[model samples]
Target: MVQSGLSQPEKVIGSSYNHAKFKLLTPSENSTKTPEICHAETIIVGGGVIGCAIAFELASRGQEVLLVEQSEIASGASCAAAGMLAAESEDFAHPFMAKAAHESRELLHKHKEQISAITGMDIGLRRSGFITPFRSYSDLSKYKDRRNTTSGVQQLWWDRSTVQREALWLNRDTYGAYYRSLESEVLPVSLTRAYARSAEMMGARILEGVQNVRLVVDNHGVRGIKTAKGEVCCKHIIIAAGLQGEQLMHQVGVALPSSPVKGEIMAVRFPIDQAGGRPDRTVYAEDVYIVPKANGEVWIGATSLPGRKDHSVSANSVQRLLGAASYWIPGIKEADFVRAWAGIRPSTPDGLPYIGKYEQIPGLYTAYGHFRNGILLSAITGRWIADLLEGKRAEEIGIEALSPERLNRKGVML
Candidate 1:
């Protein structure tokens, strides 16, 4: 098993956007487990970004892995996501999540070349930064202090004139704006498909169309998983089933306090000339952001709501998104709408994601509750869990603050 190192990454300076340098990784060779109705080193229940990532990491580390998904890959929130690697875009008070997200972005960069080589796909990795406007001087003051540092991020303050010159369609009503060159966006479907394909390339047995029923338990730990198709014996089991993780955890009485936070996003396509040759940066104003892909397609999103689980696209929601987008960037008002959809983000009470093994159950690890950061957090989450399985230090990933036991301690489990 080859270990991934955190090589020093180059920082994007001034205004130029350079393609990121990513390491190339080859799949490790291991003995094939003879299919005698038997074992896998790790059995992942979901095939979304998290599950596929875990499978890729485990298999690349010479573990026999099996991934079970009820449908085609990226059919859930992964499919509906408007991928934004924006840690700093989130509130600054949440340092735990901010650190995790920032690290995850770096990990994604580290694995980019390997991921592309393994999947033989682009994955749509881009370096388009984020633009957000401040409504008042108070907002600018608070953000100015935060954006002063240039160590981990490159944020440029923009006045009205600067915003107008840089952002082609920005509304004139903004007080000021801030731009960070580190925030990025990706095509969700491309990333998800590439990750799953990469896992397969790493010798993982991806069994799509099959779902895990329950954990095969013993006094020591989880021995395997019982599936509708058959039983898969495995030394370890990782439950990365987003939105469905709590239900499956409850089957074994390991209650998890997690629920679906529904979000709606609309994708629209405009003529290249209309979009100013695809304005090189992503736009984030209010609760929505517009991401322009390598192709001419643009993705605008997303509205977040708590206690909402519906995936159906609402006409009113689309209208509201369009109206708000029009208010910010008037050119979008005339753009043709291509698609609209919804996704259920798996959110816990606190913003931190759950990682590492369960307290009462050994060999049973839980990796869900990533909320909107799944796409960004996938690679590191995979590497972290792989390290845990290989008897490495848990502090190596600095994820001790995000533990499943926190749900139990806070009396929030179930």
Candidate 2:
């Protein structure tokens, strides 16, 4: 089945804001197996940003692909992402990660253009950059040397006056800021759907509402998958299944060292004639980072709670987010409160995502544990995975540092 990309995403202001009402297709107790058999060169299990990215890249390279999502695409963390491609602003734990994020941002740009040309959809991509306002000069001075360069990402310092001028609504305590134009953003679900639709346009098959998947791995390598529908034969399978896919890996023999990190976000939008208006650049203040969308909506997010799977939004989280946001950008306090929601991000033992072949199981690969960087890392994650599966060098993507085998050496894998 094929669906075209979105022409224009729905505005989140006017309507009563509701999160994506997608129900994940889970393993049914009475799910019966059928005799129907499917075939593909690579089978992707998951429909999040990473899975769609991989599917698009593989299909683009003339591979027969099958993507099976438990529910509608972008039903999980992908839809809830703030979509910040903060390669430099994030200050990754490792040098290799910084490099990966920088490359992935470029890949995202290339894919964004390709998808737009193919589907005539605007993914709400903003290259406006990031505004990291510091309330104290001491805090601002901490990154005085960051202006030099790291992983080829450069930075420009904006003095207090420059920052306040850029964002009139910003509080007076804002000492200075760092302007990183390379840091970009997008509407998360829009990009995910675009990738999936683009893959479909390239003759890749997508099966939504597919669940209860079992790997068909033999002694030699990956054979395919057995779903509730029937058998799907494939040479390789990628478990980009987010938090839920860890179970499948454990059952396959090796354990993926991953856990859930929950985050809550609130949206506050202004009328067309609002006084100061939404900040053009994303506001990455010390307390709360605010991401302003193309529309009049401003997203104040993300209270990180590790090892948390509960997606219920808490009043305390909302209060903290609002309080911090108002402290940084006072004008936002007057904006109309749209809605609040929660999502669970898959985080690994280390900071980086696990994206490489599991040597113990031939042709079996898994890519997850991106934590808050899923949107930023999705592009390269997909491309590198496809290249590796095509017999390309893993060193090109820094699999040595991001390999799943690291968990075994670290004694963290369960």
Candidate 3:
């Protein structure tokens, strides 16, 4: 519950009249003839969490929705995430983002049961909470001040002795830890697939393995989308394309400032009977996080390389992550190394995600650049997009701060 600050001034550049003057065709548009036209009320791009969530919400509201994906749903960053729903643990620069994250985390609680019931898939939703270990008194004091300023978050400070008693595998050098009881974790891939399955059940068409996808726009607004197979005639299109969003938006004459931030993570298996048993909750130490799954497997991650895009795991990153994990939980060093992988997350200059209709391009909306919090923010972003398309007032959803126009004013290049 961080205190609110003055709302940033809206930086919309020009009126709708100025935007209507430019009519640009996408690269695919020039070569394609009038492709077979399929129709839907709304077409959503990128079948990841955000897109699938929005499709599910829209379909639940009885909107005919079409979701197009270049690859399988959740095959990108959505599946590679550690799935920590740490709203309270995340550092928010704005009060609005904090509130939105809290609300989204709460939404997960409400939807978890429903999603499992509908999809018949256990999403591995766990309320294991999160603990942040500190190395020294000065480090603890610095975080204490930050946490103290946050109004309604429930946090508990643990002494070194208490921390040792609670998590026996922790290093003796650990000074203390802060525990946030409301934090939770989930299996990101399962949760994302659940959303896609539920959306399909609710009558949303999800087209995976699509190729040569591009937007078709006119003076009025978005007319449809062109794909390798055909064209989808739709009035509204939402882009939640993750790392590929920048290129997609650029094709339609929109400048989205986003880049691929690569993260490498590993999975390790531990025996249940091992000495200093596996941690029952998520543990955070500096840049390292260890998430324990119910299946005797633990996830150790991650190294954020901002400009890197290759999914190949480097030995150096793996060594660093594993070394840090072992320092936090001594028993982790003994665990069987399962696998290592990487994903490219979409990152923005400012940390906040872009979530709103483009003022310059009517009927074109975006929900991308969520970075690490994509899984945590999926539910709320879906609801927000649904609300906007349904003509809900901007103030009702408090989405003004996340408007795409902010990037426009910042002179973000394609």
For residues 94-199, write the lDDT of model 2, one tens digit per residue: 7877888889998898887898887776677778888888878777666655544454767788888887677687777788877888788888877888888888
What TM-score would you give candidate 1 relative to the actual structure? 0.86
Best by lDDT: 3
Tell me, what's the RMSD of every candidate?
9.3, 6.2, 10.1
**Superposed model 1: Cα runs more than 4 Å off:** 1-37, 135-153, 411-414
Clashing pairs in 3: none
TM-score for all models, in order of appearance: 0.86, 0.88, 0.88
Model 1 scores worst on lDDT over the 10 consecutive residues at 1-10
Q: Give the TM-score (vs. native) of candidate 2.
A: 0.88
- Which scores higher on TM-score, 1 or 3? 3
Name the lDDT value of residue 388 in candidate 1.
86
Best-to-worst TM-score order? 2, 3, 1
Clashing pairs in 1: none
